[model samples]
Target: MVPKRKNSLGGGGAIPASAIVLGGGEGRRMGGNKLFLAVDGLLLLHCVLDRICPWFREVLLAVGPKDASSLSLLLEGRSWASPVRVVVDRAPGKGPLAGLVAGLREMDSPWAFLMGCDMPWIQEPLVRRMWALREREEGVLCWEREGYLEPLHAFYSRSCLPFAEEALARKDHKLKSFYPQVPVQVVPEEAFADLPGHRRSFEGINTPLQLERFRESR
Candidate 1:
């Protein structure tokens, strides 16, 4: 969905960067395209974009080639603060790694916030703080409890594209497999607790039960 852009933005000015939302996931665990599930009154993807567009200069939806035609006209009114464009995966059936590679290749901005479309509760303060650290490394993400890293909730520079493509070429699609090839700044999970929604920013609704749980919790 390409929402209408605002005439002028006013909140401390949006960060000079772009956002790449990974909408290309197969979503087999959810039965179908979970991004189409209703959230409040809007489609899940719209809810995610509405909040995100206000904080970035441009927004890109990295979707699967099969979904390309349907998603091309998902939005038709003034619902976002920035312009949005859709880029299809060059290699369909590949995971988020392929989507990220396609997004980075199409991205014109030096830095971009990359995430999954299932995330509609991303907090602005968390995003702003992360944007401030854009130049600190080739990639920046939050490290969760235990040994897990929240790769989806991160900022990636265009410089990481080559390494990502390298991984994709070798068929090592694990999102973090390419991390070792690039410089990364790991934001401690404690610092994440300082935000409004805390770790909610990293949580994604990947299944029907998880979506139901989120709806019931609200």
Candidate 2:
């Protein structure tokens, strides 16, 4: 495990870093809350939390209003490395942007790593590399694949709250809508070439077929 770094701002504080997992999707394609779907004897949401919790001071799960009850039940007896908090989306059905906003508001960290619950194959080394790359920057740091921005799997600074909120206010829930208003560093594919499974690191299981394939592969 990488040693936790102290916050560089001085004052004898630990690094104010946290992670947010967005599990509030309607799951229209999956026919149900995909996060609860089992994989390797554990729920998909638990798998994601277990992988990312160790890397941050706090990890928050943003779920839809209806999904909260079941999720709380699933977490009852589970143990996690970092403190885990469950946050209900303030604006349900507003898409990932709303979930992001909800998670950011609850986070005490100045920066947070954002991801979808369906993306169970997140690479820790790649995540750590992105953390290192954002050390001196004050914006979102994420990877770009085949001309598409992976906003859900990225690093966001709390400083971007205004832009995010503004986009939400305008009902423009697209995650990228607020990107133009903030400083963004798009990590290219080659940047993660040396990391194993880089190609699948950003993959998400959004449908039953994908989940079935993932299960079979595992």
Measured against the true structure, the TM-scores of the candidates, in listed sequence, are 0.86, 0.88
Choose the strongest candidate by TM-score. Answer: 2
lDDT of 2 by residue, 12-33 (tens): 2223588889888878888877
Evaluate model 1: give its TM-score: 0.86
Which residue pairs come into collision in candidate 2?
A: none
Estimate, for each residue in 1-218, the C-alpha lDDT of model 1 and write its tens digit. Answer: 11121221213567777899988766788878765777566687887887789788898888887888788877665467888888999987788888888888998788888888888777777676655533364554444544677788777888889999999999999888799888887655554454556667778898888887767765
Clashing residue pairs, candidate 1? none
Cα displacement (angstroms), candidate 1, residue 128, comes to 1.5
lDDT to native, each model: 0.76, 0.81
By lDDT, who's the top model here? 2
The TM-score of predicted model 2 comes to 0.88
Give the distance in Å from residue 14's predicted Cα in candidate 1 to where it truly belongs: 1.3
Q: Clashes in each model (backbone N, CA, C under 3 Å)?
A: 0, 0
Q: Which stretches of candidate 1 lie over 4 Å from their true place?
A: 1-11, 134-144, 213-218
